[model samples]
Target: MSVRLRQATLGDLPLICRLRVQRTAWLAARGSDQWTVAGKGRPIEIFAGEVGRALDAGETWVAEVDGEPAGTITVNRRSDPGLWSPWELAESVVVHFMIVDLRFAGREVGRHLLDHADRLAERADRAWVRLDAWTTNSDLHDYYRRAGFQLARIAGPGAHGPSRALFQRRVVPAHPARTAPSRYSLQGYSGGNSAM
Candidate 1:
């Protein structure tokens, strides 16, 4: 199946929130508390607010598979305050709110989204793509490892959130000969708007 990505608009808020809730349920079923709050999923209002900010900043993208919304991701230069040293934030494109609909699982939608992040980093002249995963989600950590990320470090006690498992992968330019034409395309992406 082919995946396409487009900049997310405010109108897409409900779709993104639904994907988040779906993912939360999926994780909970697996006995993981990644996106939950006291055994229940995160409240839609709080999550929607976060996604709304990203949408307004033009940092969020929706991934569509077979012309249907399958996932969403937000990448930008701003790291959550105190999660990364200033130097690290300056040199990296931070990823957030990456969620894939369970129906699209195993279809490499997540990998394609990361590739999109890599391309965005390359275009912005950043050195790496960095993200903070759920601190207790070992499966998520392994998934990131298989996707080329290396564990940087867990945040110290001073960090405020539960998503403190830091991971980063260097931005390696894709060799032309081996690089396949992307099945996905970025819509409304402007270097000036997205650059750090």
Candidate 2:
């Protein structure tokens, strides 16, 4: 149980790309049309660029299991301005590029990663943690539902295809996880690293 989060760096560029593109095949096999585009399972260079930007902004993170990188997420103060209205962006820190290793599928690694995002949102004083899920991926939507997220209204496509299934959940304590002494710490994070 050596799960923890650490800030991603330039050195982690390949790891970031790998995380986003790896489980995509699993997603496609489940009859989901999400991220099955391009040979790399996604728009790799563009995604890598986004990860680089988040790395510069200190918003990207890696979740490690027993010292191996198993997942990653990008939690930031806003969503694509064109996709979300002013209000939603104002009240939330948008979550993006969340992926757990396919190998850790049944290990609750995704849940832990999201709980960590909630903690980050709470620390940043955001009232909500929000995300735009893949529109056609019913299973992913159900997964978010099981994670306690409520479906906000779906937005029509602006530029980025139709992965606009908006979802949101409140920022609250991560019960029973002993996050108070947070087993993980995100370096360079401005918020108190108190782990709760």
Worst 10 residues of 2 by lDDT: 187-196
- Give the whole-model CA lDDT for all candidates, comma-separated: 0.79, 0.71
**What CA RMSD would candidate 1 show?**
5.0
Winner by TM-score: 1
> All candidates' TM-scores?
0.87, 0.83
- Per-residue lDDT for 133-178 in model 2, tens only? 8776677888898998998877775724556778889988655353
Model 1 misplacement above 4 A: 39-42, 175-196
Cα error, candidate 2, residue 33 (Å):
2.6
**What is residue 100's positional error in candidate 1, in angstroms?**
0.5
Per model, state how many residue pairs clash: 0, 0
